[model samples]
Target: MAGYSRWIKPEVYPLLAPVGAVVGLMAMQLVRNVYTNPEVRVTKQNRAAGVLENFEEGERYSQHFVRRFVRGKRPEVMPNINKFFSDPE
Candidate 1:
């Protein structure tokens, strides 16, 4: 639907590209992981803070993980800065 609208407004194509790429990658990941086919065991750690932090009493726990099958393979842990400070490598 969005693609079809591109013909009416060509400028919308570029804007749609980033969103399309993300959606496509997510869809591919879902299809790949549907059968529990993970080529590698990926371990990741994350820290969370701020207003949305999940806490109970005096204990503070924050971490999240999920299986994803995307076109890109994250073989290594790569840290990226916020978009405001992002730069080409």
Candidate 2:
């Protein structure tokens, strides 16, 4: 490593060093924008909408699965038990 370092000219290194530093700084700013900028906010909103759509799709899938596998078993019907317990006299 030291041998390779010695081959670089001192004058040329200083000029190239700042160019590399500037490039690294700009790359950090680009990464920061992905986490905190409006573009990211919009992307998050779109993702949330997609998740809600998927949830509805999943509900449908579950209903289909139960109907196919349960063999004539239906979802239990509510007995309107609340009506009997309420005071009405």
Candidate 3:
């Protein structure tokens, strides 16, 4: 306790856990992005960009996990609320 107090103040103690948690989460996200994200993996491949390569790259990016997930969901409107207001009864 005495040794720790000399280096770090009591006031800063409460902040240490949260800060550490946030840093840990950030590091985990960085690792995930570097290892698992398609875009990052594609860039890391270090390939020369020819016409076919460019087309393939576009396809890869568009078909990334997030993109595919969002694309699978249907777009939503206000169920004709906008049209109802515009048309007037």
Question: Of the candidates shown, which would achieve the greatest TM-score relative to the real structure?
Answer: 3
| lDDT against the true structure, each candidate | 0.49, 0.61, 0.70
Better of 1 and 2 by TM-score: 2
Query: What is the RMSD, in Å, between candidate 2 and the native fold over all Cα?
Result: 22.3
Ranking by TM-score: 3, 2, 1
Whole-structure CA lDDT of model 3? 0.70
The alpha-carbon root-mean-square deviation between model 3 and the true structure, to one decimal in Å, is: 7.3
Candidate 3 per-residue lDDT, tens place, 1-89, comes to 78988999879989999999999999987886676544554562443442343566567655777777778555646747767887887
lDDT of 1 by residue, 8-37 (tens): 587776878899899999998676554333
lDDT for position 73 in model 2? 56
Alpha carbon lDDT at 40, candidate 3: 58
The local lDDT score (0 to 100) that residue 62 gets in candidate 3 is 54
- Per lDDT, the best of the predicted structures is 3
Give lDDT: candidate 3, residue 19. Answer: 100
Q: By TM-score, how accurate is candidate 2? A: 0.35
Off by over 4 Å in 2: 2-7, 41-89
Residue 64 CA displacement from its true place in model 1, Å = 17
Question: TM-score for each prediction?
Answer: 0.31, 0.35, 0.45
lDDT of 1: 0.49
Residue 89 C-alpha lDDT in model 3 = 78
